[model samples]
Target chain A: MPLFDEKVKTQLVQLLSKLTNPITLHFFSQEIECPTCQTTHQFVEEIASLSDKISLHTYDLVKDSDIAKAFNIDKIPAIVVSDSKNTLKGVRFFGIPAGYEINSFIGACLEVSGAKEPLPQPIIDRIKKIAKPIHIQVFVTLT
Target chain B: MEITFNLPGLETIEQRTIPLDSSVIYDVIIIGGGPAALTAAVYCMRKGVKTGLITLDVGGQVAETSVVENYMGYNHIEGISLVQRFKEQVEQFEIGFLQGYKAIQLQDGTIKKVTCEDGNTYMAKAVIITTGKRWRRLNVPGESELTGKGVAYCAICDAPLFKDKDVMVVGGGNSAVEAAIDLAKLATSVTVVQLLPHLTADKVLQDELSKFNNVTIVYQHQLKAIHGTNSVEAVTLFDSRSQKERTLNVQGIFIEIGLVPNTELVKDVVALNHNGEIIIDCNCRTSRPGIFAAGDVTSVPYKQIIIAAGEGAKAALSACEYVLLKK
Candidate 1:
């Protein structure tokens, strides 16, 4: 049997097909040897296969730092969901999006696509108000 | 009456049979199988490292979540679904996962030899302890007996199962607070029972919890006993200071008191902090040179899935470095 039931697959496919805007799922995998990245990539592939609007962009974080830097992606297995013109400025989902949360994520994507006004005031304010691109570095000793 | 091998001639002829000092080595020995360990296995195999994972469970506590809301992408997901996805990823990468085996002792230095409960032994040049911790049980009656019915360790894993049901969460930490808040979304009412007078969780979580009208926090209370014959039907708690007894008619209880590190296997071999967490540097190196640890078992702050996965990657990278340097 398939890992996901036919019902779940059908539901997810339906969910993605109904998306109002183009969703570009970007993944930054540094160590392809790392297993989480592989899974993350697979998840992205599954979602991509289900929908025409879903585009998967994978970058080797170790090799393409500039691309990751531009996208504000520092870690591996990080996914950025964007709009029709591939504007990376949207709700960014970190880590794997599996389980019941996938439905909500799909809902959020649909909601955010046509939404001109903020749904959650806090998250919108955090997304809209862009401070200067800041780099943080820290050094500490074990006390 | 047991027979013994008595080779007197060979035993007496101990004329310096040159002992060859040798150590066992592994290409990739993962310490955990949670998101981090399994993910590391996939990475190591993709990088052409002989990968093997030694973990207590496949999904860790994250699997116990009733519903996952904030893990990006999915607005809501069952904990089992997330774990299944993780497991599928590991299997796809051809990673060797030791099911039902716990890494008890790890001897570090030149070579790594790990022993499990089955007496099966493995040698590795690199060792990563992904053995995560277990949630501290309530240790009260009806707690273990009614686990699946109502007593749960994770709200994300089981909250969906309790839709429109009354839920009770024990403990005052961030996990307990978060569980109550998460359950409040699905359940009709969520009651939080805390042993202390005040919550120990961060102010943010406490403040956010206050916003939920369905939530009620009961302070200075301890779970006296869980009641229910078939499934969890109600819970009894005793006021710590007043010693007054109070029972709440509830359908579910999520125990988020705390976690105890699964360092028992390597307790004697590695240095543990006061909390019994394995002591490790930022590089994921334990007190022993060849041995490394990551995830909840280590002393790293923040036990989120993303953070654990990151730490697991660091541990594997560090293990690779140790192998290169030693060789």
Candidate 2:
């Protein structure tokens, strides 16, 4: 069965068309003990297929443990969205980014692909003023 | 994060919207992103006035709903799908948008200063407040302390966390009944504690709720307290008729009570009704001049999506008039 319905797929394709630059989605999955791993991988695959600018790189969580650690992935079904040049944008989805979480996932894809709206100068300056290394985690409901 | 949707067959698109600037003093600034706030943004942008919209998230209460059957255009649509459409429409305009930041404080004057939680302030000539309501808390013991531990408010978001466990849903409204239904599918048991003798939800919702065999509804019972040390161990319920209290074991609790307006920022500036909603006249103007409010945050009769959108348009027109007159 398809993860996205036909209507949703059409809408998602239109949204993905805004991506001017290429963005890579690195999906990590394992078969055992990880119930949502395959589903999350399928999500990444289907979304990547929607746009030519999107590329999916699947990795086995157990067999590719070193690669997963390099990307700072500590859980199964983790997805790392990188820019055109594989530059990390600090965007990570720990679990299945299904349901409403797809909005944020698509947002990250657009942002990394250089289709993001420009932030105001003051807000930009404020972000630059922060000296500490910040890690922000956002949680979304999938029900 | 960005949201992009250009519609199916639109060969052309309008001018693009830019990010709101703190240095620019807009003619009108809306302080929300719900149906009301988004509608106001469209009106303000169409009026050729410099407008800015500051919100934590677009599509407030409407986004969290499961389905919206009476949104005028569609017969039936998912709540998030409708929200996505609303957001896409707003994204097309040239209105200045500041998403993911809330308007923390509002100072009224010729040029009002709307302070966000990030300490950055945006100035405007006329301010339209559309920051809609939020989920009302349980206010009982351990609710605040054990928010993430066990007591959750969003059933759709948190139901998966209580898989195979017992959970209790508080309230008897549509939200409460829906929470019970959501939990009953995954949890071992679902208990609904209603304050009244019967559920206040619609007949359809009550009928659907009765189909779950694992679900039990206790009428004339109210939640007294949530007792837990680390996580939710149990909940204390109070019976009104018997005037007795009993404890029930549950690992999770979903507080599906009603919502309260997000009027903490403008409570002192605007005159509010007994329900803590801003008192707006027919023009959506508040007690103080140069300030307007709309949607669920105001003393509107109906809290439907269409009503909020209409109120937003009125507020925007009123605000534009105020700014032009002041000029």
Candidate 3:
């Protein structure tokens, strides 16, 4: 029934089990002529079934324009994962995070869900060293 | 157009533009609009940091992709589709996306300043450079005229469409070899025309190519012209050593020669390697502070989709951490 096979879903579930906090996956999509939107939904749902901590929330970008406006979601198949505290930590995964980095995305979600920020000793020392709010502007070109 | 988000103690939010030399202060300003810029925007926005992105176009090279089978999720997807999805996600936040503008200059110190092409300027605490590279052209006649008709830069998107048809790959590098091997599996025949005397690809790919009978490797050859009407019909080659010319009957041409880093804007200001690649540390931090580079533009060894996205994520995370320290 799904484009992705059961084996992939099983693997996603296995990864979801290792997560320690609740991750709310907010999916913003449209209905018509939208195949990838459905596919993204299926992937999230498959992963959702693996853990109680993971929840799937859907918002129609066209129908629920207000909600879409709130999240600034203008396209379909956009996902936003937030921790239980309602603070947004992660971002929209453009296209799909498939292949090798999917595992790293899961890791980011787990880290964000835990909502723990431990500053490195060097960074803390650096922050203390600064007397004012320092602004750093970096310019990079594609090479 | 500016949209203001309501936050405590943020009473009067004004929409204004500043000149580059006016000494306006900013926390951070980013240039370019590809994966690196988008990821940086997300990270900075989440930290409740003020950030700005300046660029004329949004998607960069990723926008031209027809099918992204390797970037992840779904068996396949159009390149524009993925970029639109990314744009939608960025729309949710209050990140300043200065569209229709190009950054022309950069400066150092606590407050950095960047001048745009239109004479508008913005200052920031830090800057992240995510401008991706541009694929070099074959420079052969008809290659440009028949681009969409038969010439393509991506193998994954055009390979399937050429099933049972004859295809030609031009280049001596790993990308060309891998594409030829992949096309050999689908097309009727695959001919690799290289400018070098021999294959310059890794030994593993050269050995793998040896197993494919449908593939023919032509050394010391270069594409001189592409013949076609509405689509590609044939390709002309010139022998470098003998100075002789030959023609092959083919319908498609995949140019895998190489890519030129899109570093024109920042070349004079930043330190670049001999190949024009921006040299960065392990964390995607560029030679200059508040400036980070990622993806194919950097001196990273491997150039793959997974590696680019991983580098993009790292650059974003690092930008986020950098902003927190500034605050």
Candidate 4:
């Protein structure tokens, strides 16, 4: 059975049809000790099939050590979303993007596809002056 | 637990596009994603006012609720599901959304400025602060001393840490009862300490609490202090009716009495009541011109979802008129 129902799939198709650029979803997962790895991978694949502009690339965290390192993936069931030019915009999902997080995932994809920064111009200008690499980790719960 | 392929019905295929003009100032910027904030966004968007919504999470306190039956148009629905519907409706408009960011401060000026924790600032002609309330603390002794040690606010987040250990829940509202029910599944024993003479939650929740085997409900008892050396080991309670005090040996204490308004961001920028709730007029206008407040964060009489939504609409319409007048 499909993860998304026909109604949801149709809605996604219509939503993704307006994508101006293609988006790639890189999924990292491993089979051992990972409960939702397979399901998350399958969910991404199912979502990718809804629109031609969206593509899914699967990687085994254990076997594809080099690929995982390149993407800075440290955990299983991770997703890295990039724009049409394959440039990482620091958009990532650490676990299964189910529940309300799905909206954030899709919103990230649309933002990356459009190649537009959601921040206001003054904020973007201030961000451009950052001289050091500052990593921001936002802790969130599935609920 | 078995991994199921069930898709969460709380999600929608909603997508929003950011405006290409980076320098454009939105007519209104809403600082929440709950029923009130989303309703304001919808109303503002329909009025052709450029709106932006910034929130740490979409559902606010509603998402943490187990079930919602009081909201109109639905006999019963999960809190998260109802929030998803609100989100879907709001996404139909061309409003800018900055999710997963916490608004740290609000600066009042000719154009209001909202500074987020993500190091981004937003400008708007009108601002509506709907950031709802959060879990209220017991404010008893040892609560602040051992927050992470044992006293917790979120049962869902910390329940697994107390597996097989006895825990106590404070408060008699829906959140407290629901937390007791949820903790009973994992904890060795669950005791509920409520100050009221009777449980204030719905009869349905009260009925569900009665079915739990390892749950104890103590009424008319006030939580005087939390007791522990390194962690939460016990809690001291005062009996209001009997004029007696007692202590229950428990490893964890979950305080869910109620919530206090999330008005810190605007406390200095606008007028606030003694309870730290933003003060708003009949039109949802704050003392500061071009600023509005709504939802649980405001000094509203009721904190229901429908009431918040209605207030949000009013704030948005008022904001629209305010912006037009300035033009």
Task: Give the TM-scores of the predictions, in the order they appear.
Answer: 0.57, 0.73, 0.54, 0.66
Interface RMSD (Å) of candidate 2: 9.1
Please list the residue runs of candidate 4 whose C-alpha ends up more than 4 Å from where it truly belongs after superposition: A1-143, B1-14, B19-22, B140-150, B154-164, B181-187, B194-232, B236-247
In candidate 3, stretches whose alpha carbon ends up further than 4 angstroms from where it belongs are A1-143, B1-26, B55-92, B99-120, B160-164, B200-212, B227-233, B282-285, B304-327
**lDDT, residue A48, candidate 2:** 90
Candidate 1's TM-score reads: 0.57
Ranking by DockQ: 2, 4, 3, 1
Docking class of 4: incorrect
* Per-residue alpha-carbon lDDT of candidate 1 for residues B160-242, written as tens digits (9 for 90 to 100): 77889988999999999988888988999999999888999999999999999998889998999999999988888898788
Please give, for residues B1-327, the per-residue lDDT of candidate 2 as tens digits. 222222333322333768788899999999998999988988888888999999888889888777899999999988888887777777778888888777888998889999986668999999999999988997998899989999999997689899999999999998899899889999999999988988999999999988989999999998999988999999889999999999999999999998899999999899999999999999999999999999999998989999999999999999999999898
- Displacement of residue A42 (Cα, Å) in model 4 is 12
- Which pairs of residues clash in candidate 2, taking residues 3 or more apart in a chain or in different chains? none
TM-score of 3: 0.54
Q: What ordering of candidates by TM-score runs from best to worst? A: 2, 4, 1, 3
**Complex DockQ, candidate 3:** 0.02
Q: Which digits, one per residue and each the tens of the lDDT, describe model 4 over residues A35-54?
A: 67877877799889988899
- Candidate number achieving the greatest TM-score relative to the actual structure: 2
What is every candidate's C-alpha DockQ against the true complex, given to 2 decimals?
0.01, 0.11, 0.02, 0.11
Candidate 4 chain A TM-score vs. reference chain A? 0.81
